[model samples]
Target: MKLAALVIAAACLLAPPSLAAPWLRTRGLGRVINGTATDIADFPWMASMQILDNSGCGASVISSTWALTAAHCVLASQEMPGAYTTLRVGSSSRASGGVRLDVAQMIKHADFHMSTDDADNDIGVIQASEPFPLGSSVQVVNLPGDGYDAPAGLPVTISGWGATATEFNPVYLQRADMHVLDRDTCRDMMADVATVTLGMVCAGDPTMAICYGDSGSPLVYGDMQIGIASWTRPGCISTTSVYTSVGNFRAWIRDNTGV
Candidate 1:
């Protein structure tokens, strides 16, 4: 009955209001990646994977051997040991091309709290068995230099293997073009949460925003990646996506990832 127990536990996680339909809205503006089937040959750091064949997410290569993703994704990965788990990066789509990296270790942020939906420190690091190839189409995205503030309205690229609609993981890694939103507006939207700290930034539109499966998608501005896909409380349709602001926690990330 292990399988049955696991299934029941999974259902309990889904009981959160964030997982409900009212909070789930779909968008069509992003590029889609088929589950573990995208061309990331150019960005070996932007890997894709499926957790229990349900949630689809992306990873960022922080160091030569380590990749970063959301802690929520790590928790889901822990729940499902092996079920078509793979990592692909540096491609517009999973099918066309990309380098597939094998994971040797997964480290979730020590401060991560999935039960209370605390995404403040929702980051995780994945150590690949081997260093990714150093060449074209498979290089890591450089973290922004010191004191990099993500100015409002900068157009950034976000990609993920997340679902195109509610309760679905897209068949391809979806790439979307979005502009960064102001911090005050984002905090106002999540006013219910008394502690929306400086570590988070908001993005996406009211009708078309990141959804349930887009966790860990990078928010890159210019040549530096400044944020990570974190949460959608009011949901994807509410014009606010709480992101783990990399700029605010660069020291912490560097200390943990050592890169």
Candidate 2:
């Protein structure tokens, strides 16, 4: 129930010491390998989470005060209370051009867990110290209705400000047009690698991939957020990317954060 428990669940490989999420085998940019760059104005809901001072993960604005992300994304901060958690909304650059707001609290799912290869209830909601100044460049995205599941092959787009395969440090947010892959197929592809669960949904793009900063970002169809970026293969192999089902956690979000 406590985030400290998540810190104990960490098991990383080939990853940088500066990165703290449980994105296995991904050094710094496990995903967004060949994604296309875009401006934050196009995806105003994008929340660039900063742990300490560096870009830590991605999130989505849901209200004037709350933003949504992944549990693992904030796990490291649980051990460092003094660490400042900042969210840069309405920013195109990973480190600049956005109104930076310090995070006041972070709450993960009560049942959140992470293993060497798999994670469950990975959702997290963070609150800013004060309400964000909402506008055209800073807006909220809608979540899927309770129990509304994203079916296989549903088209979706994921956005983040992570490193690309060509640019180790990209300045603009990246978007990957992807599609949902049924869980049965996802489990088959991830065999011996991870354990797929009802709590998670799978997606991928044949010609694109995600990056390190993609973790905790939104997986959207139209204006609805259905998933939260979770994990992927070591090199975005098969372009397979996993995300926490925002569609599956409506009550959890309301009960936990009143969002």
Highest TM-score, which number? Answer: 2
What Cα-based lDDT does every candidate model obtain?
Answer: 0.58, 0.72
Per-residue lDDT of model 2, residues 101-212, tens digit only: 9888999887776566557788899999998879988999998888888999899888886556655445677787878999898888766566778888888866665555
User: Which sections of candidate 2 miss by over 4 Å?
Assistant: 1-22, 25-33, 80-82
lDDT per residue for candidate 1 within 70-125, as digits (tens), equals: 77667666655454445665566644465666667777778776543345776777
Backbone clash pairs for candidate 2 read 29-212, 31-210, 31-211, 32-210, 32-211
lDDT of 1: 0.58
lDDT for predicted candidate 2 compared with the true structure: 0.72
Q: Where's the lowest-lDDT run of ten residues in candidate 2? A: 1-10
**lDDT of candidate 1 at residue 78, scale 0 to 100:** 66
